[model samples]
Target: MAFRSFGSVDLSPSECYDMLVNVVTPRPIALVSTVSADGMQNLAPFSYFQLGGTSPPSLMISPTLSPEGTEKDTLVNVSATREFVVNIVTREMVEEMNITSVRVGPTEDEWKLACFTPIASDIVRPPRVAESPVHLECTVFKIIRHGDGPSASNYVIGEVVRFHVDDAMLEGQMMLAEKLHTVGRLGGDNYIDTGVPERFRLARPSTPLSRQ
Candidate 1:
């Protein structure tokens, strides 16, 4: 007979979060910055973020409402300005990113608190992180709101109009994840980075799958 793990394990919320954090291998964390309606800035980190792009080159950041169904600062700002920047989180600035994760008043400058420099962008009033190895300047494409549910979160999508990168962070035409040392958010306050571990890649189809 084959043995099973779930058979003896309880899948409670806390346990599930712990397992997901530790077992997801690694997930890219997005340290997003946005400006509120009154011209105040807000910074927050989200693990529910990832690339949903190409063509127009888009990105997605989700700001989950609390149990009371109130929008987060990031979500509110993005909706108003229709613009924001998605800065990649790296191991070197992991501590700063964590500080930005704190939920505070819109007037509080997370950048000042975290000691990150702000650089002007071509198309957006909001700024990008000078310390980040890569920055994506985006204009809001759309926002999908969710009704009250177990895990409902506001999904904000943006079109990338600009991209910046540090020359040292790239190897030839490829991004060396190990060298970039990007960090990912785990369940709670925990995070992990590229361990310089073994890796592999699969072949890509030259033609669109839909045409095949």
Candidate 2:
């Protein structure tokens, strides 16, 4: 067998990013929405997202600073209002979600740009994407800054205050994944359709398994 390895410090930011995203494989998309202090609404999609914990029902999204070292509108609005909504991206909204990822002026409304219908959120000022099947209304629990330069990240830790799910995608209180048809991000200009027919499941071991 042969292999190649290089120190992370030796790789440029772009190269590091490429390697990370390529290997991460099908990261869940968080279509985050926020409202600026002045009431300007902002919407964006991020794949650097995951569930933090369930004790307080927390989730996190890491928004990286632009190469020019400017904060993204989503980060700016989230910092100001201390609230945002994470709308789950499904196959039906994939194109619009991609559109929202485009760079636009802070004042520009990606909701309108993507032709998405915005419905009022229950507790947060930021509206939820009506087209999305699942919406997690979150309040900022904490903001952790990693670095203060280009490609730096701001990890927004949010508590899910409320959850809104489409009735069609729900079986009582449980959400049916097959019905949701969620989409996931891959390395640049690529995405994985999780709604595809192919799927398999593995049952967890009741006790520790012996090594072969």
Candidate 3:
């Protein structure tokens, strides 16, 4: 196979970002919702997200700096109140979630714009998305910043305080992935449907192998 390699230092931030997103296939989307101190709702979708750990059940979402070199609304709100909610996006909610991605003023209500019902959360000030299959109520653990200007990224790490799973999506104690119909991010204006019939399970090797 023929391949081309480019040095990281040789590419612009935008160039690197475009390439990286394509290389990192099928990233999970985090539909994060937060509330300002004055009770304004802010919701946005972030593909640069992951569950950080199991011990404390941490969730991390990285919001890249805006074109004007400012932090995103979700970052600002979480900084002020230190609380937020992660609503797992499903196939049915993708269109509404995309509506929330529109750049709007701080006073704007994304829930209303997206036509999503805001349900009262058990612990967080920010309401959970009623349509979402899973809700993770979190308290800010830490905000780690990287780089400056266009290359900047803010990593908001949160500890999951409460987890709400829809009854229909659960099979015994496990959440069925197919029933959830989760969607994932791809490069550019692309996404992947995880509930398709392509899923398979692999068991880890039973015997440990000796190091060469």
Candidate 4:
């Protein structure tokens, strides 16, 4: 099989990003919202998002610096206020979510452009996306920066303080994946739906017994 060694290829930052996004398969999208110190609200989608773990219900969203080497409003707001909300995007809300991905001035509001209703979060200053099926109100645990250019990343680590799930998508404590229909980010303009056709569950194996 043909293989491309990233280190040996000497790819540009954009090329590396393209390859990483394409090779990562489907990644969960985080529609993160934050409030500036002056109360300006910011919302944007980050595909480089992952769950830290369930023990403390943490989440990490890696936001890159803008082309001008400036921090994105989401990261700036998060740094100032140390709070944000992560709204899960569903298939039905893909269009609206995409609207928020547009690059706008730091003072501009994506909620207005996206036409998504912003509901007040219980503990966080940033509002949650009302159209999203799930919202996680989080407090910034830390911000770890990597690299030193426009392509550099700021890892926003947030601890989920409160979780809100739509009633129709929940059965007791379990969230129905089909009902949620969450959209995942693929390479470029591609996206995937979290439906039964693309989902499967595997039981974890128990630890091996010790040999006598």
Candidate 5:
């Protein structure tokens, strides 16, 4: 089999981004909510997200700079307030979540645009998306900037202070994946639905193969 390789240095920012989003394969979406210093709400979705750590309960979401070198409202809000809420995106909320991603002014409220019910967060100024089953109330731990200009990422490391879980989605201490109906991002105009039929479990090996 022949595989083509492209040099990173030769690719433009947009080309690199296109290659990345196409190859990453179903990245989990973080529907992040934040509030400006003036108390204006901002909501946005970022697929460049992941669990940073388990012990401290941290999440990392990377928001990239626009083509015109402008910062996103979510980044600006979180930077000023150092607080945000990460709402997990499920299949049912996908359409509304996408609506929140539309480019808008700093003062525009995405919660109203998406028609999502926002519940007052107990710890953070940003409200929790009532439509989401899991909400993580977080305070910014650190902000790491990579590169400069368009498509540059600002990695926001958030330490979760509180968690809001839908009681109905829980089975004792565990929240089953089947109940969540989580959706993930693929390439352009594509999304992955994590249905039970598409899932399988594999047990981990007790010892390394090299040791055996």
Candidate 6:
């Protein structure tokens, strides 16, 4: 079950997109919530987000261009306001979160259609989804737009201003991982729980090893 030739399976973007989602096991789903200049709320889900830093905290989210090659509302708002929230979707809210992923006009509020409560944020104008287990408020400091196509993505680097976590979900000073039960994206419509075994720490090698 291996491709020995490194360059043999030259995957097209479409093929890569499919295989990555399918074979990469599971990817973290970032159900991003943002607000436009006019205060209209927008919601979209992307598996392209990852934690970037710890000191003062930061997050990196990629908002890909739409099929028509224009910036999506999430990208425009992130660029204009330089702010957004990364809502962590759990098992309970999967359906509602998926509903928010439906494409709509910039003037529309996906929150309403999804029938979820939008609560006020502390430092950012964009609100957080009340149903989400965790919410991270962020202010964009950089945008890396890729490709020349109309639908090119913007790799946004955002600084965390505040983190909202449900008190009930915490066990003492640590987060109760089993209780969180976060959902992740797989290839196509498939998904897997963030149910990785236990957290383990591995010691770093004291000396660098020479390459063969």
lDDT of all predictions:
0.75, 0.86, 0.85, 0.84, 0.86, 0.79
* Residue-by-residue lDDT tens digits, candidate 4, 1-212: 99746682598888888989988978999999998999998889998899889989998998898877888888888999999999998878877787787777776678998899999999888999999989999999999999888868999999999999999988899987667777777776777777633533222223232111
Supply the global lDDT for candidate 1. Answer: 0.75
Error of 2 at 80 (Å): 0.8
Candidate order by TM-score, decreasing, is 2, 5, 3, 4, 6, 1
The 10 consecutive residues of candidate 1 with the worst lDDT sum are 203-212
- Backbone clash pairs for candidate 2 read none
Candidate 3, position 212, lDDT: 12
Which residue pairs collide in model 6, if any? 21-187, 69-150, 69-151
Residue clash pairs of candidate 3 = none
> Using Cα atoms with residue i matched to residue i, what is each candidate's TM-score against the true structure?
0.78, 0.91, 0.90, 0.89, 0.90, 0.85
* lDDT of each residue in 1-212, candidate 3, tens digit only: 99988999999878999999988978899999999989889999999999889789998998888877787889889999999999999888888888788777788777887899999999989999999989999999999899878548999999999999999878887987678888888787778878873433222222222211
Candidate 3 local Cα displacement, residue 80, angstroms = 0.9
Q: Report how far residue 165 has shifted in candidate 4, in Å.
A: 0.5
Scanning candidate 4 in windows of ten residues, the lowest lDDT window is: 203-212
Poorest lDDT segment (10 consecutive residues) of candidate 3: 203-212
- Candidate 2 Cα errors over 4 Å, as ranges: 197-212
Candidate 1 per-residue lDDT, tens place, 136-169, comes to: 8899999997756434668898899998888886
lDDT of 3 at 139: 97
The backbone clash count of each candidate, in order, is 0, 0, 0, 0, 0, 3
Question: Which regions in candidate 5 have their CA more than 4 angstroms from the true location?
Answer: 196-212
Native-structure RMSD, model 1: 11.3
